[model samples]
Target chain A: AQSVSQHNHHVILSEAASLELGCNYSYGGTVNLFWYVQYPGQHLQLLLKYFSGDPLVKGIKGFEAEFIKSKFSFNLRKPSVQWSDTAEYFCAVTSGGSNDYKLSFGAGTTVTVRA
Target chain B: NAGVTQTPKFRVLKTGQSMTLLCAQDMNHEYMYWYRQDPGMGLRLIHYSVGEGTTAKGEVPDGYNVSRLKKQNFLLGLESAAPSQTSVYFCASSYSSSGGLAKNIQYFGAGTRLSVL
Candidate 1:
């Protein structure tokens, strides 16, 4: 089974501060990477995903992620953040073939942006 | 449009009690999955169904059973609840396309919080 590791457990930043969350997976083959965010009392929503294309993928709310195959990492980043961006972020990965139906998720990173 | 819906938003069970969690999807997806989320353990898959009448085990499937009688409905059952089973359960569904960029993008439910004492 593929495993995902998130570098940070919790992060705090002020408004307009740059934010970056580190995520790495343990798969070496073809893989699909994703970032999902869950706001307070809300279900998880897709931030972005990378299948097979440019390493850098942009998502909603000014969020973007870079998929570095060499490092086995797909890190999420945002130049500026707002109070609304304060939520729990999860990094997930799924490989090809019969195992595509399963997604292995990271432990998650909680971001708190103070306004 | 309710993409995926999980019944009984909150549930409490005794040590030996039995309960079922219901999941329904209106998007006509071919794949459905059940996962449990703990404090810092992230989400762990308990069971999944590729199509109607077909189910498979995931990373953590012990003490849990699942049934897919209809294409739109998936049921997860616990014959005897345990404290370790206490967590927020989420149901997700995704369209099964052979070769598409949006094939496995899962849509998740609001989740059901379960507590076993």
Candidate 2:
């Protein structure tokens, strides 16, 4: 079974600080990776996705993620985060196979950006 | 576009009560999904439909029933509600993949907060 793990449960950062959220998935074969963010009182929205491309994928906002196949990790990073970046982040994966198109998601990490 | 919308944004149910949660998508996408978000539990897939008449069980489907009788709507029913079923439910839609890894993003609804006591 495929599972996703996110190391951090709650993260606190001040405005202008750098941010990095770790995500790791247990899947040996090719997989699709995704990061979704949900602001307070909002729905989850796609942040970035990696199917087949350069290891680095950039999404909306200043966020980016690196898909490291060997380490089974796809960590999200932003050089500088603002108060508006406070949200719950989720990492998900889907095994690229016939029986597992459904995504498995991590427990999620809550990030609070202080101004 | 209305995107994905789940009705009854908030509801409270007594144990053993039955209710249906409706999910509707206007994107004309070919795939619809139901998920429940619990504290420390991420989103667990409940059910999904590939097309108007086709439905499949997802990771957690034992206590729920689903119907996708129309292309734009997917309904999730709780035959007998329980406090354990209290959670925020999300609906999502995506393009057709025929069981392949989908690169297309899943558009989500605002979510329905259901509390079963």
Candidate 3:
């Protein structure tokens, strides 16, 4: 079965520090990738998505991810982080083809930014 | 619009008790899904509905039942709750764009946190 893996379980960083969360997937066909973020007491929101075209996709809150097909990876990155960025991030994938439309999500990474 | 809304933000149930989670969406989305969120387990789909009156099982459907009697409503029921069923539940909906086309992003509810003893 297809699955997503996020290497980091938890990450702590000072405000203004750069951030990167690793995500890898196991799927042989074309896939649509996404990054979702959940802030404290808020619903999960889409940060960015990579459907086709550009490998580098920019999302809300200055977050971006690069889809590397060969590596089967779509890692989320931000040059600088803010205290408000402290939240949980999830990576998801959906293979192309039928309208099965199911998303496979990674375990998730919790980031804590200290001021 | 209230994209997706789930009722009873928090609930406590004892083993063998039963309850139903109500999910409503005003976006006129054609697809709705129920998922459980647990620590270390991002989100496991429990059940989904493609359209009104149609329901299907998802990744983790055991111990859960679903009904989509109305297009804007999807209900997830726990016939007999267990401690293992304690977790945060989320409801989401999305529009179907057809045949390999990119679908609308899923809109999630704030989530219902359920504790079973």
RMSD of each: 1.1, 1.6, 1.1
Flag the better candidate by TM-score, 2 or 3. 3
**Residue pairs in clash, model 2:** none
Runs in model 1 lying further than 4 Å from the true structure: A97-99
lDDT of 2 by residue, A1-115 (tens): 4799999999999999999999999999998899999999999999999988699999999999999999999999999999999999999998865445578899999999999
Ten contiguous residues minimizing lDDT sum, candidate 2 chain B: B96-105
If you assessed candidate 3 against the hidden native complex, which CAPRI class would it receive?
A: medium
For candidate 3 chain B, the 10 contiguous residues with the lowest summed lDDT are: B96-105
| TM-score for all models, in order of appearance | 0.97, 0.96, 0.97
After best superposition, candidate 3 residue B62: deviation in angstroms?
A: 0.6
iRMS of every model, one decimal?
2.2, 2.8, 2.1
Q: Can you rank all candidates by DockQ, best first?
A: 3, 2, 1
Better of 1 and 3 by DockQ: 3
C-alpha RMSD (angstroms) for model 1: 1.1
lDDT of 1 by residue, B31-109 (tens): 9999999988899999999999999999999999999999999999999999999999999998887664455689999
